[model samples]
Target: MSGQQQINFEKPFIGSIDQGTSSTRFILFDSKGDTVLSHQIPLKQYHPNPGWVEHDGLEIINSVNECISQVLNKYKETNIGEISDIKAIGITNQRETTIVWDKNTGKPYHNAIVWSDTRTSSIVNRFNTKAESLLKKEQQSQSQQQIVPKDYLRDICGLPIANYFSAVKLRWLIENVPEIDQSNALAGTIDSWLVWNLTNKKTHITDVTNASRTMLMNLATLEWDSKLCDFFDVPNSLLPKICSSAEIYGHVESGPLAGVPIASVLGDQQSAMVGQMCFDKGQAKNTYGTGCFLLYNTGDDIVHSKHGLLTTVCYKLGKDSPVHYALEGSIAVAGAGVKWLIENLGFANNSKEIEALANSVQDTGGMYIVPAFSGLFAPHWRDDARGVMVGLTHHTNKAHIARAMLESTCFQTYEVLKSMEKDSNDKLVELRVDGGMTMNDLLLQIQADILGLPVVRPHNLETTCFGAAYAAGLTVGVWSSAMQFHIGKRFTPNPNIDHMKRINDWHKAVSKSVDWVDK
Candidate 1:
């Protein structure tokens, strides 16, 4: 509704293909950042084994095509503008979701290994052991090293050796899927998968933001690292070329927006950062989605996290533009925790009912939930952690558990924010939030209460899509500069509540969740 400003027939529009973990959406936005037309399709997730998550690669492309067709049809019905008025398309997707396919026939060797999948935990452990052995050999030959083996590549790739990244996922495919090899296979994240399919298999490229998450790209050089490839045992030839986040990559081969330049590509979290207009250093934004991601803009300099946070590329607007960097804290469970409440615990019928249920209670009555369903990410990269709901009693009912569920996300954000503050050495004045979870006012207030920082939601909650739209729009001159959207809601922290005690209790609950699965 915020984008309902008078539609100028003369102005051009931009389209963003948001390929998330659970859904795919095609959104058409005018120069003013108004939604001209949009369509979304829910994606199916497959779990053939516990700790494994996947998506059909072909299904993802098909869903994108379907969304594009539906949105274009709606645009035609409205007669707002001709399809030709859409200048370019941008893509923002779930980072670290690995897909491998044949370069010639474009048939996937296996389902896309989703970012949330932990089937590669064994692979991670092996790599960590190998790294430690290598480090021991070096230490015996030279001076003792201070750094841990798991963080051996952090200086180069800005990521820990964990299963949450693309390298390990790619490694698992290479080892497990026998057919995949350098001869015919091409591998990359979802952005590469979509671009290759959209351009009729002509363009095979991934942007800097997506490349950073692969844990194989050199953050300084912005290219695939040979050492990392060797470490993961993945052939460099099987990977796509790395490019800047905003540039004309190629044209869509067919459909309603045929021949339109595919101008930009960013991992979803980085796209949200751009959409939030957090260009200045020290600015930060949190996206509450399937998982929660808080990114603190560090401008051009890449600040290595002394804490457990990650240093990553925020965005590169064009090939010539300077690469902006950021400190990122990733929580693997946020909205997924809510979904677990609905489907597993049977708390309510839908997520919207969660707020009402949470609000019905005054407090959680000392209850605390650590939703470490797939281990814990950021600040605590514990793969052994499991879901735990502590401080339960006879008085604790559905409402208390529901409130604790919501508070779990807030508490996770708080931990990430604290780590980010220490890593960046800049205290954030406020946190700009976006995504579906921000729609819940009670959640935002709880977030503010927990973090003791103002939580600001944009007038348009579609920042992830709009961030991609902004990148593409800027490239095609749909807009000369980034358009600023007004704030929709702001929740200030309550001074009376002592948040630190609750945070400490959250840490205790988290400790209880760890080492749940025996090594």
Candidate 2:
């Protein structure tokens, strides 16, 4: 009772800018995984052609600004702050979406080549077959020449050479988009693109997680892999400087809220890993979204996969630190299958309706959908494996297709995580799950049953946003480190043994769907 005045409020608020594939979301979180104030805005997606997908870079930036502004406004209305008492900001963005801009005008040379874009499919196909083979052959032929392994799909940087990653897309831009080259286009992944814009073109930088996806950063050196860069026709000048995921890279020079420090950047998946507090070796998670991505943190050890899995960096905090790596297996389709039902098939009214339709069926009725609509990734990589459905009799209906589509997501994820465990020779007791689809109880339970492991779902399904916030919180001396970040709920594995039999039968159903696409 000695106090004449008292200031109340115990902890700090952390803001996260989650720049994702479909939209940009800004969420404010307290120490616990509680959403204090949040706002999300969907951006316009551009389809310039049948196979090409793009998002306006300026719009992406504007949307990000708006998302952050919305959350800040809500905070003010809620008595959180008219003046920011925010500790830090974390940025987790869609990896591999390539955006090139003119440094002078600070305008994107063209619409960003979203990670979903397939403009480089033919290029990737040709590289996979010919140039990659020749490089391996040459390496093997030379006796003292660090002989490359047979059938080795050479690891470019710490990443696989694919149309999904950015290096190939950057090459495509240089070769095809004349305007980009004429501008001496400065190119980067989505995170870097945002960083450049955020810092007012002062920081052309990206973190280890995002850079690792570019097919240009060496897993060991933690620098841009020059050999791979040259191979991809990506000039060193076009690349951003590599930086730690958690560090004060630059300050906000101009924006709605000026003078705030811009700290911490991670690829969306790796950021989710941070958000989930997956700080140990063998800890793994699968994000169920437009695509399902399974990443297993291998820790300091770089275990090259004997299986189809690709070796990639999980995240790195400092330059000299042991580079924690991961084995990633990606499915080209997940929520997109549900999305297709909305836009293409008219099978479901919205995302939730797809779940209802799927539940209508007791099972898929031996119908399997391999959503290779884009291409098969990891354990498959058959770009030629176009989407197909099998066991489609007159009896099959939208319910069956819906069930099969949702099943495909779990099945694909099962195959990937299965391969990761196999490749690492580690037992996967449980898998941490996130993303929009992970909200579905049926999907979560089936995911557990199909994998025969606990599928842990966090309370705040937006792990992606929290991850970035965690990083930002760390960088500004708000949070100590990644290990200190608090986590929410965990979904334990509890698949009934009876469901195991059903899962095995489901696999057989999947067999009928594979290789159905014409080469």
Candidate 3:
């Protein structure tokens, strides 16, 4: 597998704990980004109220341990290597999920505030109205906030004070929870909490990529902006020390695989960059999980989009390493459309079935289902946009709705990618895609046709886990370089009828679905 010099067959295996919003997965990868084995466990989510999302932090930690144990145990029978030869582990997680835990006891003080949680809108309103002095401090010091002519946290973070990030969550906790307010509470995102748990509470740290999303880190400095910390009413002591994405964050002390070094912590989107091997400026990738995320590599320059896209850290190699910046956009709903179909509409029994049903229809049959369930995002930024269907005729049945649901996701991505191209002027010609929805050929084809670009999907669809494994593998000298990995597969754009006309009608359908925002 060597591009030049040959090495022995003794490459150490690297494991990754990809704790995401939907599930927890443990993936083991060899040096060349090839999967050796894997295990995944679905996580339980609590949506006790609208816009209030929570998860058990202990469940998150235990799932990681359980997956590692399961994968290692199963790998014991493989002759490729022994369990004892495993080198290290890397972690990539859904960023912005907030938690407050005891520094001494390692117990979560409350359920984690998921990245999707929108419980802090009123809190944000209060800050925007009352905390002008504090907001100014943050605006000057925080790099992302600074990128915009000020008032840019929502612009550059692809988030708002409305609670999809750690900052407002921390603010809400500190204000409402009595225990956290009066003590030295350890407050941080999922990465910080997991790093703490893994190191036996020895390391309370997070990487630059994760930090940038918090509306706390200065994009340029890659450090916690002291002013923003104060602006968000977060005590300086409560935050985690920021580090590089690829350095040794901590080491495992006690677990199914103890004593292994933990390196390469990344937000899931950034990790997918490492997985897709998007190393150059203008390279872009879109992930279709519960929601859709499009990220374009902008090199070191943070473009600070006028459109509703974010300037965030793609990855930080080290404390002193040059940070690769990215422009990111988030859609309100994607695969959640399929979930709604199954759970609410009785269209299908499972998510995988939606692909076949979507394929059954030649067209959406003049129907459109804009899934603005929570709100619209990206260039639209219409928090008022609510989920609604338009142009539904008698012929518009389950298949058409399935197709429309799938097309809705692509259109949302198309909007973001177009905005990304305009903001960075990169003109994305190809996009690497991963996550659950990429498994759908019908969806991928539609994505290709609509975007008028090649959509490359890797053989190992688990890009998030693979990226973490790659990072860890590099740190331990297992996969010395990611450049050696081969391109697994490519799904090119297919010819469609009346491209311009189809686009017009599709967009026309979209226009009708508006005005439903928050009505």
Candidate 4:
């Protein structure tokens, strides 16, 4: 369970650049999939307006470089492994976070619009109107009845027309940022940004997993659809070339790890699925980080969610390998909620102290907190929704609120799981989990009790990084196949706790949060 362990200096290692929403990390994994060394740097978030989130693209890339330098220095200090021992590097990044930069200068047009930002709500509304008119025209041509607007491209992209996707974000930037010229600008998610900089701007590419989340790539063809590009009014020239998750896209141009082949790239959640070894159909994993994401592997089949979930690319190991799809339910808030408690509400000094404070109370005193801060994501994609805490009384204290905040994450996760089962038509025997929040034993126990299923955590909670490492290692022959990873902890459902009533109460709180923002 310890990240520091005796190293086999003679073997090859895989380096993973895990660029996430709130931070960036560089981790080196040995042939056994164990963490050899790692370094992390916290990222700065900007909110000039409400419901808006942004990250400085320059700062992000700088932080990434700093992490690489720090980890490399630490690696050399060990005197265990030579720099050349790292045969390949991989990247897993926060998906849907759009960045537009000059193709020639490599300068971002503006701050990277975060995935959680809702500033593009107006753009979504405009697109919905246009889509409805198009649908009506098509129906009239076919001699069919006209209907309300629906997810017109969901069949193609496996995503709804929402502000959560990169297309919408890019549209927002194009409309607002007058200086950007579509022909001279390039747009992509975080993975593309890092890969471009890491290779000294020699490459501009994105893996299938990251491209799928952009709402531009066709789920069936795995390519950027011209029709979609036209619909969003985003130029295809602005996009990065899509590639497989595991391949040598380019090499590190300058660094201690320079000349290393950049072998693999995946969206963070999908990478966790790989790290969890959910290769078979129906296997699922939930990651609790800045947000919570649950992905259910559907093997080669793309199962569209009748319920409110997204069908996305799980992984495409190589150019010739068959594509794997997944049903994903994204929660906008999880660890971020805990963070809000510390930075905004002053609940505790840190997440650990908040857990301690919550344990002081037996329950939330009949309270419920619906963290619809950036609006609800899955099952309820309401951009108008806002955060709400109901069932408060004179007796409610900080302890009660802390418990409610923690319970909110568990409750949201349970809803997503139910939706996943409905879409897949198969029940998950156990839920595999990884992320920073999984370190909180109370939260995991509550997650199990709420779902009435066992929650499993791997000994290495850094599954996000490990997944990238696994794919990169596999590509370079550092590892021949998936290695066995042991489970660290398991929490079974509490037989005595009947959570139905509380779940129902939580639903009521969620309902109260919606429609707070007028159209």
- What tens digits encode model 2's per-residue C-alpha lDDT throughout 274-344? 87888899899889999989999998887877677777788876544556788888787899889998899
lDDT tens digits, residue span 363-460, model 4: 99999999998899997888889999999999999999999999999999998999999998899999999999999999999999999999999988
> TM-score of each candidate?
0.98, 0.91, 0.91, 0.97
Report lDDT (Cα) of residue 332, candidate 2.
77
lDDT of 3 by residue, 47-87 (tens): 98987889999999999888888887776654557656778
Residue 211 in model 1: lDDT? 98
Q: What would the per-residue lDDT of candidate 1 be over residues 217-319, giving only the tens digit for each residue?
A: 9999999999998988888888999999999999999998899999999999999999999999999999999999999999999899989999899999999
Backbone clash pairs in model 1 (N, Cα, C under 3 Å; residues 3+ apart or in different chains), count? 0
- Runs off by more than 4 Å, candidate 1: 1-10
Clashing pairs in 1: none
CA lDDT, every model vs. true structure: 0.92, 0.77, 0.79, 0.91
Give me the overall lDDT of model 4: 0.91
Q: How would you order the candidates by lDDT, starting with the best?
A: 1, 4, 3, 2
